[model samples]
Target chain A: MGLAVILCLITWFVLVNSRKMAPLPVSPTSAMVLVPPPTLTPLPTPTIYVSPTPTQRPGLPPASGGIQVGGYVQITGTSGAGLRLRSGAGLEFDPKFLGMDSEVFEVKEGPVEANGITWWYLVAPYDESRSGWAASNYLQIVTTQP
Target chain B: MDIRPAEITANRANSIVTIQWNDGHRSAYPFGLLRAACPCASCRGGHENMSAEPDAEVFSTVLPESPATRIRSVEAAGSYAIIIEWEDGHHYGIYNWHYLRALCPCEECRSRFGEAV
Candidate 1:
């Protein structure tokens, strides 16, 4: 009976001590949690620009010479010196204005023989105020009116 | 006042026709103005429509560059009037001294004669 009481008491003390022990410490690699990176907003697409191309008129011959009444002409062959526009066909008439090189003008009246030169009356398109007679030497026909 | 032109000169270089009056006053008329104010019976639309003064519309009218507006010659009619021949071959306008004075576009004349004349 004394031997049985001793063994029972020892077992009870061991159970109490086992219950008081702390849990095991966690490892750093095993404790890590997988998280996704934050979602990003995308940038707008860039706009592309293209240059304009000149289109050729079909069946129309390129203008070279022969300015007619109601036709359009451009000042050329002046060596950038510009052409003189006079109030009258003759050189005796005062200069109305200086027509710049490559400037376009519409033929209003023309072919007046004066000062041994053929003169054509030219007027600015859409503006009759700027009109005068110009010699044919510097004028290139741009287009003839039908 | 009897206003008579002492001298009439067409400054084609400036496109202005100037008339020097006996009273020491000068009137400069634009080539366009004279063409627009052509006093010919046909230009006035009819003989009955003709008047001593320029029509009210002539002052404000802007005639385009044409043979009708191009002065070929200006001739005296007797001693009181003058005739202007346009390059277009229209020469019936007989501009008298009284009518020409009234047609002056100067500020002073416009104020004195009024724009309607």
Candidate 2:
């Protein structure tokens, strides 16, 4: 019986020492607690830019002409018919419209010249009752047509 | 009272666009006061109420700086307003007939009121 007790004590001693000598089994909870080292990521940079080329567009060329009328003066013939000469374009006077026998003023069908100034003229008959040029500044050229 | 030609020139430059008058005077005007006094739908009221006053802030903001807008050319629209072209290539402002006619700076508006008064 004494030998058996000594053997049991020796076995306990061996078991305790063997536990200290062998590697400890890691716990599941403890294993999960380990933290990994942080990873480094590169950030993207923004770039600024300017345009080096000019944009092109298609269209008609700009207008490059200049023409304007100066002034107007009423013309009277000596016949006492009270006829007034008027310009439809402000550049020429109406010579054919100077008398009562003339027809309604129509711009002379073609370019006409008077008093050394060249322009397109018109001819209209003078109504004896209407004493002066009906309208002086009403005449103007339409410039945008061509 | 004495008449200052510089003042006349300045006032004439300030207002009185398209100086075509019955007495045979012709000149181009600026967009400053004219823009302020625009009688169109946007500036003035509309066609129905032609006499409504324009907003003061709009007028103050729109006055062109001096040296004033250089008039490239002027074209007549009937017996009333004129279409004007500016040196800056803006050709949209069409001045009305009554406005141009009323800008006569003779003894009437000048001596009676003040310049552009």
Candidate 3:
């Protein structure tokens, strides 16, 4: 019985230790056989997000009963006008108007009533000229302040 | 830099402020709004903590006393900025280039403005 027990224990030890032993070596010919893994390494690529260009804000809206115009005083037609303050009230161009040709102008301080309707008096100056006032029905109001 | 006449032809759309460089390079700057904000020392210096005042009051107050404003031309300082000679003869401010470039009013900027662009 002891002898039988010794044999059984030897078998158990072999079975457990066998798995831990060195792996069986393959033949040279068998080793040459190629096998590829199922998974693949993917290449990395960069992604870029292109943004769009922005549009310019349109000139200010025309006041009621009048239109704003802009352009060089010497340039004919509305295209040359930067922001014109044309009035149906028969307003005439006066030297009192601060700006000359090629000058930027803005509406400052008024929508005062004249003759019976609200009018906008523009404060503008020549490129090199100091700020001054000009009369207009067409006021180009800037949406943003300076 | 090769200074040349600006290519401001009748066919070309006129911009609010057109800058032509000495090298014959031209850029159109819209005057209405600035995306990067004004680089007037007041806008840049105070808010960025680069200067003492949190506002630009000090710089503006000194404008009336500047001599550069006597000149009519805007002198380009570098690829980035210009020296604005105010009508009052001030030349104390240096407008940086990025500030001007960011002011482009193209369709992209407008859309952004409409939706926090």
Q: Model 2: residues >4 Å from true position, as ranges?
A: A1-146, B1-20, B23-31, B48-62, B66-70, B86-93, B105-107, B110-117
Q: In candidate 1, what are the lDDT values of residues B23-95, reduced to their tens digit?
A: 8776656556788888889889998999888875666555554667667778877777888888799899988
The C-alpha lDDT values of all candidates are 0.68, 0.34, 0.35
Runs of candidate 1 with Cα error greater than 4 angstroms are A1-146
- Model 3, which residues run further than 4 Å from truth? A1-66, A69-146, B1-15, B20-37, B43-71, B110-117
The interface root-mean-square deviations, each candidate in sequence, come to 26.3, 23.7, 18.4
Q: Which stretch of 10 consecutive residues in model 2 chain B shows the poorest summed lDDT? A: B2-11
Tell me candidate 3's fraction of native contacts, as a decimal between 0 and 1: 0.00
lDDT for A53 (candidate 1): 17
Compute DockQ for each candidate against the true complex.
0.01, 0.03, 0.03
For model 3, how big is the iRMS in angstroms?
A: 18.4
Q: Best-fitting candidate, measured by TM-score? A: 1
Residue by residue across B1-117, what tens digits does model 2's lDDT show?
A: 211111111122212232333344332223344444555554455666454333323212334333333444555544334555545565665555445434322223222223221
Candidates in order, TM-scores: namely 0.44, 0.26, 0.29
Q: In candidate 1, which residue pairs get closer than 3 Å at backbone N, Cα or C atoms, i.e. clash? A: none
